[model samples]
Target: MILNDFLPVNKADLLKLEWDYLDFILVSGDAYVDHPSFGPVVIARVLLDAGYRVGIIAQPDWNDPNSIDILGEPRLGFLVSAGNMDSMVNHYYVSRRHRETDNYSEGGAMGKRPDRATLVYTNLIRKKYKDKPIILGGIEASLRRFAHYDYWDDSVRRSILFDSAADLLIYGMGENQVVEIAEYLNNGIEVQYIQHIPGTCYLTKSLENLDQYIEIPSFESVKNDKIQYAQAFKVQYDEQDPIRGKTIVQRHSETYLVQNPPTMPLERARLDWVFKLGYMRNYHPMYEAGGGIPAIKEVKMGIISERGCFGNCSFCALAFHQGRIITSRSHESIIEEAKMIQMDVDYKGYINDVGGPTANFRHPACKKQLKVGTCKHRQCLHPEPCEHLDTDHSDYVELLKKLRHLEGIKKVFIRSGIRYDYLMHDQEDAFFYDLCQYHVSGQLKVAPEHIDETVLDYMGKPSGKLYGQFVKKFDQINKELQKEQYIIPYLMSSHPGSTIHSAIKLAEYLRDINYTPEQVQDFYPTPGTMSTCMYYTEIDPRTMKPVFVPKSNKEKAMQRALLQYKNPRNYDLVYEALILAGRQDLIGFHVKALIKPRTNVPKAGGSKKSKSSKRKTPSSKTSINSIEKTKKRR
Candidate 1:
């Protein structure tokens, strides 16, 4: 595919196609990369396949209105997105420091897109064409369709609809919503009258009585009180199902934000058609001068066989953004994509990844999920796997088996993530045995998050015992297969429920395992997540119970340092944290001690305590058992 083959970005390309005006113009924060992994490209291609003239304006200059005028106005409307990721998250780190590089931008440079790209771009477009129908989609808009807690501002903000002033907001996977909105506009219907489309949110002046709709707390109430915000979030969370979900309404002063029920998840055939949309599968040549996008490298050969996740970790936004209902393509569809991947000029024997949010999740959690939608208040795999939960991985196992045997494919690895708790629930171990025997490339990565049960409870994760059982089972299976694969468990520090004591306990657990993680994730409170709500409101929305949150930088640093207590640089923080937690016994020169006693003289006003005469030898089993007992008691 040449440059002209791509959707026109400027007047010259439009002239080549002999089109005076486009049906729709897409404005994205990311550089144009016509790949399925990129949301903007997928929406554009879907529109184009529907026989609409779609043009793109990627990373337009927010500083100048003329930059948005390059594509002029579309006959249908404007589709605005903050690229594949939330703009604030893409541009800044948890520490509120500007990121040095943006993988979404050309050459991995910074500042190609502005902060709050959707809001900024929409305002710019409105400045030029005041009456054009502007629609917001992508992660930023999808997750913030309701009133949300904005980490950058440290305050609760109103819905994106009020702020962006866009006619409609398409949340979740927008393939279904975008098409419906386009067709409505194409039929000469005004954007204001197209409010009833599923998966789309629109502003309204009056509340209409609809039996199928539920009303959440008004924005004024949430803004004035955090408790109201949490309550509102719970109501919104309960109505996300496509099969049985109801339209949600929340008042913002005189106007209202009415979110229609989510669009039904695409079936196998529709999903296959979307993936086979003849994507160029590469960055546009326009980026050749600035070096092609680096983000493309990670996903160029990866296959997203499924969409959505049922492993709804509280910290994750997938449930709210992608919905909990899992939808997957057929094996034939995936195999065909993999065959195309093999023919790529840069194709290697290895396929990067073969999964979605949760790689092993091929279908809904259970048979009932398809009929009744997901259980609103209950979870499928947390606490313990529900009896109705489906744990079969035969389909996934067969899919992987076929991929590995495909010509020119040496190894097909599952790099996305595996829900260990879900994997452990499988009674028959065919998938487990196969994963250990074939799929694992030496180490299988998993997210245990933390070792403390109290912290795990607040995280909506299973108990530490489940993770322990999984670790033992993984080792047992590996041993049975005569394989030497290791488990690289992902750990998080300074999460909402984590205190100094919890951090110290986690550190001690790491000491017993004789492993210090090279990387530790400091809890990031992004918008539209239960964890973020807790970080802001200091209350669990599900139970409305107060939660202990680690908010201070010093406290957070201590927790993060404890995860890497083995490092010499972290010795002081580790010792300080231990003392603060009343675990100073873990600071002496002994096998059980997390850190050795300071040899240097004490600083001013600092007192030293005498060392214990008797010290018990460190035993991994004893330490692990003690932690487990503590969890049980809690």
Candidate 2:
């Protein structure tokens, strides 16, 4: 409510706060939202708590070099981040089309920031203050800190530090590294010499005496050879732990890129302190008259109870950015944050979410993970749950119980992704029962991704039969509780190994259930995901086997259309997809059919005849069971 509640955004703010120069100036690609959900704000607050002056420059004009001159040069250096979401991912879609509206900007406007925002902002800062240390962090720099694939360029590019010529690149949750770097810089250590820190990457002219570091294929080799690129990705993926991980180096042209091992995750108390460090918990007032940031509406009432995830789905970037080891906050911390929500004007007695990357995972998958790090060759939840895998949800259930009974809170929800396979793996059903009773807001969304065995294998997802079992259990619980809640399964269309036949199979599953997903996810080959590596190499890095990548836009469209077969608008594409897959058997009037015959197509909106979609419907549970039974019989 006051001008000083948020960090200083411009010269006027610095003047109002009576500051002459900032100790650290953070350049971001998002609207200035002083909330804990935004990474830039967290880093800034951490720096401020360390007794340093910090200011922010959000969405600066690329054309006007003076736009960054408002905050003036910092005494320590300038910090660069591409906002919470990657800028390129924010600006364009999987189809490479520009998104019409920006959720992180004022008025939901697009083009307020440029593509590859970290590089742009770093270059802008360098233009004003040459030789000043430029530190790169956030998802953009974190994922692309090494030689990796760029979907927009369709080629492997050098590290952001290499391309931007920045001094340091801090990856992962950067609270630990940011404060360390600040103290070192405060003591007058050169940024170039600050290379030994973990969870960071830097460039060097020599790799001598660094025998502890593992050397991977160089930029030239990976860019030209797909196999080598896959190998490099595997090394990076396996060696991301702070405990067991070693330093990794890759050569680019003449210089070498060194990525120090990941920083140790914050303990419960540190995570609690980070979240409780006086966040405004809202977007800046400058945007209130301009419709405000749409992204804040989703997380303003939400609480991040944990960090990291062991559900290492290959398509997800969490493993690369947040690692697989789980770190969580304590009950008191989360409950206090929940009370903070009551102070919001928009609080309606509902807590939007209370989980992080994966909702139910509160601790490491096993006892050994915290000490020795994750196994290099095996995953906790892939192929099969590890023998030491722990599936206890008592902590999370208790947290929600305390929150549900809070004075002003009416309902507490877990909107974050729930690993159904992990949840069902539990021996007891207490958390499942609690989840259904307290968390179900008419529907629970889970990501089974795809049902086809081969695609699921490539995606590192559990077998569809497991999802079916989970679904059955979900239905039984909701029914027993007398709640009319439905399971909204998040389905994906084209992934690395998903062929038209595979897509047709998923469409058939949807047909069998008589349910259609409201939205479809196409596999996006972002910079730092194993699936993206597979997408580029056409080979699964884990097995070194060939994968069928659906790259054609038309084929992807057809696959997407198959998911919405009931819509008359998708008839043509769905018809073509089924025909191409030699699935004419699924194009007829049978109850198992995915689409109507070509002759039965309506002229516009939808169907008109009694033979249309308004026909008799079957029980969704029975239909899903039938699907599993058919798969088993086949």
Candidate 3:
């Protein structure tokens, strides 16, 4: 239980370790928490286990030049990252307003790190030590390796390596890539010669020997034309697999940006070894007086049983970052971690979660994924399950059963999102029944995203009819078990293809179900997602088809208000949206009406209105059959 067992973060710690020089100095935007959930910690631990000396510098002052000099220079090079999240997304909201809290910081404080953190940190290091090699890895660097649209600046920018002046950019999960790069560097190989490694991006004077690689549109073309940008993103999206993926190259003004194929997925033993490292499982003791790090609470008791995802939602970045191949830990590895949790002094007989990107996904999508990789043009679960998809849940079910029966463990909940579409694909009912009986804590959260068929199609999700069938099956199982469990759905507003009419349709559906969501999430256009491309260019990247995007603040607000029309504050916006959508007939006082008409009341000096002031309404039927079908859930 020694607190000093964590990575060296200061000069004193380096002195204690008796190391005169280190191989790599890792810089991160988040406060150092030596848990597997944090990206910097995982990469640092992997490098450390490879017999290389590593030190860390977290959240250094960007205004002062001497802030990054605490840890002297490393022997080989420096590793730079912007922590678990992208710096811009961590600092600002969709409205371009600064956020009040930073979840990855101590005490939930803000202003810890600067914007474009990878660029800032790399430049800072370059200012002090101009000749040293600097390598960038993490979400901020991986997604920005190509010329991407900058939401904050409202313009397309060149590759981050050009701005940051870093030697190499390691994309995706960089366990194998980092080790290979380190081994090459340690053996006296220069950074210029390290471009041939897989999962690394670098700038070249020409595409001389890369005729076999797939050439994308140049940066200048995409920066000027929105249609070309969509085409470029489509080419990038289709070639992310490790097996059949080809090396991709894009041209800038004078240089070419070459991105090698993704690194191979981790095998069972390698995945287990990475998680079994000596993680402190909490924030460093120096931050204990500041109430510790808030981000650690999310995974302190939760076990990441797997990695990668096959459910490629259009709005999610997992496909680009973690890839669409699923890799998991052995059951013995998971049980060993759970046993460690049972020994905690604060153990309350509860395990928060036992899943990764998607909880139920334990292995690759199918047998062919191991050899040929995932399909380049189609997704495994989107639109419909592939004919070759292996949808067995037996391994997950057996693992959960063993965890719940442990001596000191009490309730085990699956808080991570479960893919209901995949669950329904399974022919057996054992996993579904056991999930309802054991894993649920009164409510199970799922994401159907939207009910409109057009919007669902744009979202890369199944139709609403599939969700209806799943809901019916869930209710039937709960009834048989005599439990009062509920399924709370996560819905989104103002996604691509969702027009004013579509918003009104969602509002009417909510009214019929007699349910209201407390909060609604507006679709955020983060980098490296198919949906974000549509949001910025008004065209789908996959098919280059025109899409309806809600970009104005007023339009986005009105769409969000329609989801929560029951709130008195949203009455005006909802009323206006209904009128604009040609649904003014739903303004009267009736069971099918969405809102009441705006009427003037008597002021201090005015007279009261008569009963005739209320508008007369006629009985109407609004999707009564759909309402009856959904009555069991209520």
Best by TM-score: 3
Least well predicted 10-residue stretch by lDDT in candidate 2: 617-626
Compared with the true structure, all predictions reach lDDT values of: 0.88, 0.88, 0.88
Model 2 per-residue lDDT tens digits across residues 171-227: 999999999999999999999899898999999999885779899999999999999
Writing each residue's lDDT as its tens digit, candidate 3 over 1-634 gives 1223888988898789887888899999999998989998899999998988899999999998998899888999999999999999999988788999998998889988999999999999999999899999999999898888887888889999899999999999999999999999999999988888888999999877775898888999999999999999998889989998899999998899999998887888999998887887778888899978899888889999988898888998888888988899999999999998887776799999999999999988899998998899888987999989999999999999999998888989999989999999999988999999999999999998889988998899887899989999999999999999998989999898887677888888889888799878889888888898888888998888788777767777888999999999988778767765558888989999988887756546667664534533322232222223223322
Clashing pairs in 1: none
Query: Cα RMSD (Å) between model 3 and the true structure?
Result: 5.6
Q: Which is the winner by TM-score between candidate 1 and candidate 3?
A: 3
Q: For every model in order, what is the number of clashing pairs?
A: 0, 0, 0
TM-score, prediction 1: 0.94
- Predicted structure 2, TM vs. truth: 0.94
Between candidates 2 and 3, the one scoring higher on lDDT is 2
lDDT of 2 at 322: 94
* Candidate 2 lDDT: 0.88
Residue 67 CA error for candidate 1 (Å)?
Answer: 0.8
